[model samples]
Target: MDEVAGAIADPVRREILVLLRDSRLSAGEIAGRFEISRPAVSRHLRVLRECGLVRDEVVGRQRFYLLDPAPLADLAGWLGALLRPSGWEHHLDALETEVHRTRRERRADRREENTA
Candidate 1:
């Protein structure tokens, strides 16, 4: 759990995981999406790999990264177990949904204000 926690502690690594959740990507491709250097991205990938959140395979000369969701499931299970206090999960879910809806409404209001 230490590795999983460590891997998820970084926002950049989380974004990388989200990207790889859809499909595999090369180190260069991942680096291209950020302002950080290639070596920095490589280091982030290394941490992710060590945590078992991601797996890298060397095909020819390039390294490609793939997401491993099993660790995520483990993490979620642990968190769920820890947060089972008086049905807090449902409250949290409702809070999240409301926050997202509020954000969408704010964006729409901003767009309308801008257009007028």
Candidate 2:
């Protein structure tokens, strides 16, 4: 997962991932979209493959890279936890404190009325 995160940290690599998301593309096609040299693009692809974020297949002498979302799914699940309510445990604790405060105030009010 560390490798996956590191591989996607680059904007160029992220774009490459997006490019391969819906369709498989040869190394050349991927390089054509960027102004960088083919070797640089190839390096990015190699990192992505090593991270298990993408898979390459040799199709008719052409290496086609395809996105494999399994590794990303782990990251997504981790990020999803951050956005979820369970992530906001402190907020829930605050709400619970407020509820208890309100209940104590109500109880005190009733006791004063009964005493009067």
lDDT of each: 0.92, 0.93
Model 2 error, position 85 (Å): 1.9
- Please write out the lDDT profile of model 2 over residues 24-80, one tens digit for every residue: 999999999999999999999999999899999998889999999899888888888
How well does candidate 2 score on lDDT at residue 2?
74
Model 1, 55-110: lDDT tens digits are: 99999998899999888887898898887756677799889999999999999999
Question: 63 in model 1: Cα distance from truth in Å?
Answer: 1.2
* Per-candidate total of colliding backbone pairs: 0, 0
Among all candidates shown, the one with the greatest lDDT? 2
Top TM-score model = 2
What are the models' TM-scores? Answer: 0.70, 0.73
C-alpha lDDT (0 to 100) for residue 89 of candidate 2:
87
